[model samples]
Target: MSRTLIITNDFPPRSGGIESFVHELARRRPEGSVVVYCSSPAGSDDAADPHFDLRQPFPVVRDAARVLLPSPRVAARARSIAALEDCDSVLYGAAAPLGLLAGGLRGRVRRQVALTHGHETGWSALPGASTALRRIGDTTDTVTYLGRYTRRLLSRALSPAAAVRMRRLAPGVDVERFRPGAGGGEIRARHGLGGRPVVVCVSRLVPRKGQDTLIRAWPRVLADVPDAALLVVGDGPYGPRLRSAAAGMESVVFTGPVPRAELPAHHDAGDVFAMPCRTRRGGLDVEGLGMVYLEASATGLPVVAGDSGGAPDAVLEGETGRVVDGSRPGPVARALIGLLRDPDRAAQMGARGREWVARTWSWEHTAERLDGLLGAPGRADA
Candidate 1:
């Protein structure tokens, strides 16, 4: 059996799309010996659950007193990889601090592959200290982008060799867990939104997510479809501002920080999914395909997303869902109104999206692809 080590900055204890991706990949690789090396905030009490067979945690710090700082953490990680007696391949989850470290160990490892989620490459120049990390991460050998647009972006940023190594790999969803026929009414009834047309938007409450844009578009949406109710799921730094934005809007509901296990119900509760992700100034904010789009699609919900970053790849324009231009609220409101106004077409589109996802984007298929890569000659050990 091949042995693979996945190095990522976040994992289960820390919640996010990258963490979920690593966890799902590890779960499906039961035939191989899989271990994960993750970074978390200091003093986090959450321990690694034994069910997954993860390695002891490694903290990625931003402070002093550590033997090796973030710059050298990859080197330390390389030593850790070397110490893994029979490991064959190292899969760096994303670039940057981890990617830079993985790149530095090119000569040391037999095989090294890097995964690039959309926003990491497109919106790296955003304000904050993360820009420095993004610069370091841009040096990986093989980069896997979530969509074609991201592949082009990375190719422009890196050399011919690095760009040639880049490939587009769509992220997968748990089909069984997030199916269309499951508990739809229970979620809606629980939230007192019986028989209402629920428009769901699931994402971190970040500036780039365009939750504010959705909020701004709500009044127009409600005006066209009076019974329409907007349900915003997940939470983040921009939560307060979003709440304030929706204060007087009776049709808007903010379900802050829903648990991962309960996420399926939230998706089931929606008649349509709205993801208006946009690029913020200074390249600080952009969408990374938005995994929630896939989840909603799997639940047979039509999507209305902005044509920016990786969203186009997930939302097939006018077929599975509508992808409007990202510049203004008018296009978004129009798309939502069009879908909500015509229930028959919306249902048809939802059914199509669900079938597309079931046939194309499941964790089993994603694992098979990754497994094929791991079984390659030099990566047999990983």
Candidate 2:
């Protein structure tokens, strides 16, 4: 059993999509099979990372990172850890810094893999980022993408030979943990959503997430179903704008930021999960395989996602949920109202979503695929 070194800029106690994804990836692997190198959450000391405890059984080394990638300090420490662990393989959570680092260790690391999400897929923008991505695509054993669209985006960065190395590996949810009937009623009661239909949106309050668009559509939703409640969970810089858009709407509730352990209940509390995500911040920021959509679906809540980016990959249109145009209030309003009004139909959709999640996505299954790609003998992916 060969050991692996996973270098990443993001990991918990940093709460984001990538942080959780990488944590699950390392968690499900065999004991002693993986060692992690990651950055501490902003303002927190490295010792504060929850998984760094010796009793946890895995070695988690904390370092620093830049906005786009881990700093040089992260790369230097990662190299030291690779040598110390005698790791046979190296996996970068994203393309930059670590991917750039992996390039310098071609002969040192036996197998190298880089996972590309949406933001870093654009090779032409960031200075030297294209070279970093190219190195991973050209030299690494595999370059995995979170969704089909993300893969297509990354393929643009690769040459003909490098394109052959591209692979698909989406983030998965803990189905057992986020299943239906897990204290959902408690959350509903806690939020004073007793007997009222609930629509929940869980994401950072950002322009790309389209919380403002959802708020704009809520007026139409309110006119039709007066008892309907819109719960906007999570907070960010764009929150003030969202709140302003939703001004004087009594039924619209902003829970701000909830704890992670309490998230499953939040998902289950909703009759429908809605986040009309679109390309924003001048069309650069995008949603790539929204794991939140999967989590909501896994909780047996029908989702209403955006049509842009790779959101379609997580949402099975009409099967588990609907992907609507996030820009227009008409389409967004219609989707929410339809789901809120048709309880039986919503329930049916939620049930299908639960089934789809169980059949299609799980951390265990995702880990198995990752294991095969990263360490399986006789598997010549590159």
- Which has the greatest lDDT? 2
Cα lDDT for residue 109, candidate 1: 60
Relative to the true structure, candidate 1 has a C-alpha RMSD (angstroms) of 4.6
TM-scores, all candidates, are: 0.86, 0.93
TM accuracy, model 2: 0.93
- Cα lDDT tens digits, model 1, 1-382, are 5666677665565678887887677767765466665554334424434333334232222222222234674576555655563556777777644666655655556666677776566434434434443344345445667776676565566655555556555579888888786776887887789999999998899887788888888889988899999999899999999999999988888888877788888999999999888776645456667788889989889998887777788887888899876667888899999999999999999999888888888888888877665555222111
Candidate 2 structure quality by residue, lDDT tens digits, 146-223: 777877777777666777766678888888889898778998888788978999998888888888888888889989
User: What is the TM-score (0 to 1) of candidate 1?
Assistant: 0.86
Error of 1 at 198 (Å): 1.1
Clashes of 1: 7
Compared with the true structure, the alpha-carbon lDDT of candidate 2 equals 0.80
Clashing pairs in 2: none
Query: How does residue 278 of candidate 1 score in lDDT?
Result: 78
